[model samples]
Target: MENNSKKIIHKGISASSGKFYGKCLKILSGEHLILQIHISEDEVHHEIEKFENTIYLTKQELESTIQKFSKELKKELVEILSSQILMLEDPIFLQNVKERIQKKLENAPLAVHNTIEEIAERLSSLGDGYLSERAVDIRDIGERIEANLVGKRSDYTFLENLKEEVILVAHVLTPSQIIHLDKNKVKAIATDTGGKTGHMAILAKNYNIPAVVGLIDITEKISEDEYIFIDADEGIIIQNPSLNEIKLFGASSKTDFGDSKFKPKKIAETRDGTRILVKANLESESDCDLALKYGADGIGLYRSESLFLEHPSNNPTEDEQFHAYKKIVEGMKNKPVIIRTFDLGADKFENEKEENPFLGKRGIRYCLQNKNWFKKQLRAILRASVYGELSLMLPMVTSIQEIIETKELLKESKDLLKSANVPYKRVKIGIMVETPAVAISPDVFTKECDFFSIGTNDLLQYTVAVDRNNSVISDLYNPYHISFFRLLVNTIQIAKKQNIPVGICGEIASDTNFTILLIGLGLREFSVSLPLVPKVKKIIQVIEISQAKKLAKEIMKLSEEEKYLEIESYLFNKHLLNNLV
Candidate 1:
């Protein structure tokens, strides 16, 4: 770790892709590292009272934080804090801490700490990295409560005083901690432990901050104010890099991007003159703006869950939702904005616990169960449609009956708006083809909906019976599987026969390797992340439709066992597998 010694390189998983060179700023969560304290039996009741008061105070602090950032921060960022607030108020989490205080005759802080550790341990033991990552949130809440009991602040105040930009190096950062940091002062982020789906990681991507996580001992090896080079795209961190190395890396980074030469183009077309519309999946206002900057054809999937998450205590009023949607619609001008209804479950909305949340009441089903909430969102989407071209998309539709019921409710919403004499436009309705049940028979859905957006993330998961979040079986979740390709082809063909527009808005869509294959499968529209627009567009412009079709035909003929290797070998040999992601 000497400054004058040889440059040290460490590797980890890439959470967000970008390159950054900045000084290191190490952070430690002191509140969560408190020493245990003992208490007598008589102090049990008093301890429970102390714990309750701490919880109450922590909730107030979280609410105050949410209020402070409600208007200034992106809705998704605010939601991450709101989710933490919900965790603070969770009955099971609160009740367990209290029981530990009373039954174990421990102090308030000790009881809270022990309960959190126990729950986090159990979560990690589930053998699912995604579920285990939730333990970070749990630990964050417990630390907040403990900090309140100990009369200490939950955030690291040192971050506020930093005069220069630096790459934050930490063992782990809670979502709230990341939010509390001065984003302008933090050039990038590197963490010892975190998951891609964690709130901290999500914030990094949303903010366009270069970050790498799960670097087991980065904080230990990296020192304060050390010059570090973060090549997040390759998941490498160089500590105390030499001047020659720094210059070489900087030149290489600039050449790779070619900022001056690479201009954003409007049309994405193939060599044979087939035009493919490349859109962006947006979650917040900033994301909408970034999409436009990246030359997105339109906002393909405008997730409304962030709006709900922004106001955890209550559903956003119809007027509030309308204004929110209107801003994005107006911003996009002539471009279509497909706003999806809230697609979360009770776990996020109601803060209710579920054993298997993926299969539980979620997406459109949750909206139907809570009809009033659904009506408010529908009314909002309809009211905003007049501002620009807009569409309404339903998520998690497993049956035609769900679509039928939703259409009826949409009518009710329109009627209510009509009664109010509100100026609105009729928006096209669409369904997200995520499950195999829907993908297998998309023709039935095509008959009822205006369009079909294949969500390959869930479709592949549901079709292959593998959880994408579970790192243990992540290898088993293959997008190259012949079964997945068949499903994609089937859905696209069914939609094509009906003349219904079909687009893919999933993780796979953003992948450049799959772009040619998707185009070959007759998919003319793609919705990817903002950063991926240029690369995907580049791939589309270079390939011819006929060549892609030939590749697709060759792929479809391979056996289930041979498809994976065959397609991979084909793309590799053709040099179409070059890293663009």
Candidate 2:
């Protein structure tokens, strides 16, 4: 029953950037659900044995492959799968499922499926939008098992049939799916659902996949083998694209994307030949190597949250934290690495098991309460500082008092290390001006801190009162708001007045269109995703800092809409002239 369906095109979020042309190789898709079926105690034991055996076999078989790719792109892929395997022994998870299944009297798979159904129903029942969204995590674990059973391993070469270059269309993608994809054969990816922070998007960005996500019902409308054009710049996916549209897109793609060297090669430079600093934002130590390989001037934001993510404990030890930070610093050598202290809290790290964890325990509030955690990280950074170029950046600080307190903590950690006969180095401490209070009161912070890094991602969310993860208020999370510019201007002026440096490490700095706007706002240092350095650097190379400053002043006076429109017009005009000379 081989029915040839006409090729259809669907739209999704373009997490990665590049043109991919290939035959459709779609995988089965399903909604997120954690189901636990009824199973006898005996059956549960047998299934557990089977799961262990399967993991053992998989590990033995994949050991050589994992070792071969260690520290490379495949390293993270292997680590993620290994963590999933560890879940089989997770006492709480296994025991909870066992009890639920015993009451239902079903097999392991059925019991898991039933529990998923129950959890899904409960989530649906919850009227609290904040709590209801966490059901996705439950479903993710189940998906991992299903993926393992279905033989869709993410080793890149698994899909032998997908050898020709083409775009991948899917309902949704898991981390493994994106990790295992063969970029040589696959040109781009478009998924029907996934947030900007989802693993699929993150994986795509890491691998340089031309991805588009957050496209609703795109899979249902688009057919297999359809001629589709994904315009990532405009967030548009065109099905049955006209020849003219393809040509126009093709031209744009040629300029911005094409071939194996998809990322921009030019470094950010000033028209007068001054080199503007370009650094990469890092989530984990593994990402540090990638940043250096991409020619980042240094690291602007080394997010410390990754240290806490995979662990069961509330905080990682100072020794453990020190090793990770040390590795990143050692990897970067002479490059300046700005490490942002643990910044999780808010809605970003929601655990269903922990009631009201966001408002209850997170960020500095959580650390201040758990001084052991705070001191460990501070001590580790101090120790790592002696080994390489290091600077500390505090996250979510609302007042000068917070900055002062954090500085005292650093001094205390340094003193403790000094007393212990452990080597330590004097490191510059900085604060992230994210909240309105901090942005407005930058002068007070400048007096206490070594530098200021404006985290526009959180700033935009707080300014608009938008839960960026929520679809309802997502539109309001505009980075181009004139009010945002005013905040930047204020932060910059205050920092400059105190003879300190200011850098932007938000998504805005990475955007080529707004590179000039950032420079014009008096931001001399820019930090972005690793892959974006060359493009941002190229933009820096073309624009004169003085001209950018003039444009920034003009934009600040315009209406928010007009301000954004003017910036676009300016970039477009530059684009026409190929003025990035």
Candidate 3:
């Protein structure tokens, strides 16, 4: 890793935390050239068999990976990789490729690649016509199966067999690509393409690796085995650093509570003795223990749709939903748990197509349209409510009419349970304040819902009119934009005026400096990815409310042009921990 060159720095989006020094390990990606080959009628049957067998092999690999890394990976990531196995077993998917090989006399690789390309294109047609989350999954799965058919080493296996500890760089890396990585040897990651909300970023955070993406041309810039320093905390990279710079950085990394979750975990409180609610956004019951381990104040978002999605048919029975909800509620032992009802749409679930799935029927709108399915989930949640403090949260709610209708359904659910002589409890209801309609008229919503959780993921997208997944314009989807902050302040103030509780449940990873900014804006609760509980707590424990308020006021006063100039200085400053206040 030793080098003799001028020091250079590059900036990118910070996808994970902690800094490290290692030799560069560049992973080059190239298109897998599948030459189309025609064959005789007799060879067509053989091609179909080969295609089926290759899928079986790929399925076995995915299963083994699931069993092997189940502990290290978080529940959501495990689900993502598990989705690949489902793809391999899909009867229609298998039939489609077999049809191509048999009818067109195509080779197994060519048939498989063509079917995948078609499906990927079809998936991209959903929700703004970009590469949706599911499209990426399909494409990654295709790469795996195609590689298996051609007798090539899979991406994870090649990367897993590395001989030395190093920083990995690639044109791009999918969550599927990093499934079998050797965490011990792969010290950090740098990539040429990715965004904060992409699956890779979520996985990188779960695995606790230092990662920076969206460098655009970093793969071409960095050479193999070169010494480089990754300041992932600030999304900065330094190449061929002097020994003096290395020593200074190395010393700080060691003492930064470098190992383990923060020991002596207790209630999170700020410097001025104000308590902060650090909640975990739970999607699966398996993560309940992990949340408790990290001293989570409560469950901020129990995405009940995950349970529905987990079912092979994408519809779990009432008992199935009840048990899962009950388990998470009981595990928390009386701590508040907020469960969001099914948030599925055409883009996410198997259903009739829409011109714009994200803007069309989704969340409460979908549930309302299908009342029977909606009531079943409501009854299950009502049943689980008695086990502990559980709340029902409606997602994508833009109007008070949705709340009124949902209440009527809740009453029907209770009546059904009452007729059956089943026991249940009435729980507080909440709404995810993500839509611009709600933000535009915040006061109207405060009187209806018990509380609000600002879902910044969708809010930022709906308000900014840019999809964060689209790399071409994702740069413009800024949380620090003056318009975004104005809307945020408006929502927070309206909720405060009505004496309603409010907090944020998304967009923490996009900007590390925004934690205090949120608190300064009067947000008291933080329901984040479970892995970030300790990091959030550390920030909350250091700063006082007064200082955060002052910073918020100053930032709000800046013009759009002046705001970026001033915020960039604070954003790029690497030593904020020591001088946070």
Candidate 4:
């Protein structure tokens, strides 16, 4: 294609939104071609020298520009560019590619591109999108190397003076690229490649942009400056849209999607006066904003696993852990945040070894065995609570004694914090009702712990003796089982009898049907994903608690074989109102 005839309309996940018109700077596929090396040993040595020189130049150029941005951006840019450069200099990869090219007697650029393409295709076929994207990065590196091998330099350019009212399209997007997008200027984003979990998908969600992904070869169909319409609801992209479609989508798109400024009302009373507590699950400090925006009554479950995942190691220092906790609490101010301690069991931790990890070392069991690691997490929670309303919970507690011992450990850590002159709030402690042992013995656990949070996900798995992670038996692990709901209600019933609060911070809480069931079952507090709160809250507002309770009673009496489909149809047919954000 001639440069004059080249048109620019790359499809991508719209990280930011708007509509505008600009001239094209089409980035063709062959620009950064990496050649395969098939020369003699002396030539191979010389090629390595060239690769080193190119890497050094790229590093120096990046370093000189580092100070122009904030620390996070600088760090990310360095990490991304550095990784690409390092891959080029990897002796193993370089040697392997060189040998393959020599054996094939092919053009170096063609050979390298083919190998990268082949590997990418294989990974893509494996069915994991995350793993497939890694292949794209490899191909990108090869392109950069190919450019160098042919005496070409990287001509990557940033889009400047972007139109303020333009819809951006691309094949895909990255977290780093999304961060740089001017959200105020862009209208919507559409991509040819991505899924709901991809970084671009998450960013588009947070930015309140209309985004559609996984459309094949859409870049070729879209024309530069052509009026287009994006409907995120149906995952539809209409190029040169008809006037009727534009009017409909434009009206829907105008609704406010950003985080609400006010904290979510804890008193989630419907117009008819049914009350429910809308709590939020915390994954990290970053999740706090989403929680507050959604008007969460409090933080229900804080997964400490994300902190460890962010760092390069399995364990973070107590102080570092405290800082992460403190950030979330400080964000909430006086609102309560329930922090769950290190949940790393043999299965969750990459470095750890355990036989039948789920049944082996997980939750409270793992904490007890790794006393020092457990204490550090407890100490961090204690220190952070000094700043705001805070509470702690132990996950995967199977026995009454485990809860008792964990409570004792909490006391020990609290005493240490007190001795150090840290002013702290009196924290309410709880245990996750996960295994059937605790569910059946709720009377014992309720008496020992301050509160309970039914971890429905794991409880369902344990109830059916099915591994939730195993796809083969996924159908068997049903949360809707009459017995499962019975256990949950029984546990909540125990908490109510004991006058100790029981909250649900599981995926089930987010489902509208289950929300009603829980309310009817005498469970008053619910902690759900931030995005689902409005809909759940709205449902609570309209639902009659007595009706739900009556339905729960009916469900409890039905046999397992008769309940699943009956309940599904009943709920689906009810036209149960849901507030989707």
lDDT (tens digit, per residue) of candidate 1 on 1-581: 22466566788766665667888888865445567677788888888887877778888988998888676566767876778788777899788877877777778888888888898899989877667778887787777787788887666556666799889999888776776778778878999997655777777876667788889999889889887898665567877665534432331222222244655467998767889999987756545666776789999987787677545345778888988899999888789999888989877744677877788889999989989878889888899889999999999999999999989998998898899898788889999999998999887887789999999888999988998545345557767777888999999998999999999997677656567778888999998766677777877776788878877777677636665666666544545433321
Top candidate when judged by TM-score against the true structure: 2
C-alpha lDDT of candidate 4 relative to the true structure: 0.65
Better of 2 and 3 by lDDT: 3
Best candidate (score: lDDT): 3
Off by over 4 Å in 4: 1-172, 175-205, 208-267, 349-352, 559-561, 576-581
**Candidate 4 local lDDT, 1-581, one digit each (tens):** 11222222333332222222222222223345343445654455455455456555555554444444334343334455556656756777666655655565444565566766776788788876666656655655666556655767544334224555666666655543454566665656666676544455555656555566777676667766655656453355654433322332222322221344533355688555756788887654755665776688878887787677545465689989989899999988689889887777787667788778888888788899877788888888877877888988889888877877877887888788789987666777888888898898788877778889988878888888898545344457666676787798789877888898898876576555566667878888988756566657766765676667666665666635565656664444344323210
Off by over 4 Å in 1: 1-264, 312-314, 349-351, 572-581
**Cα lDDT computed for each candidate against the true fold:** 0.78, 0.66, 0.79, 0.65
**Model 2 over residues 310-405: C-alpha lDDT tens digits?**
344646777889999999999898889999888776444444235554334556666666576688899999899987899998887876767677
User: Please, what are the lDDT tens digits per residue for candidate 3 over residues 1-581?
Assistant: 43456667888877765578879988887346678777888898888888888888888988888898898887878898888888888899899888887888889999889999999788767652125546767888998888889898766667777789989999878776676677878888999876555677778877768788879899988999887998775567788665544543431233232335655347889889888898987755755776887889999987788676546567889999999999999999889999999998877765588988889999999999999999999999999998999999999998899999999999999999999999999889999989999987889987788999889878988998987545345446666677788888899999989988987886552234567777888888888766567777877776789878876776677636656646644433424434545
Predicted structure 4, TM vs. truth: 0.60
Candidate 3: TM-score? 0.62
TM-score of model 1 relative to the true fold? 0.61
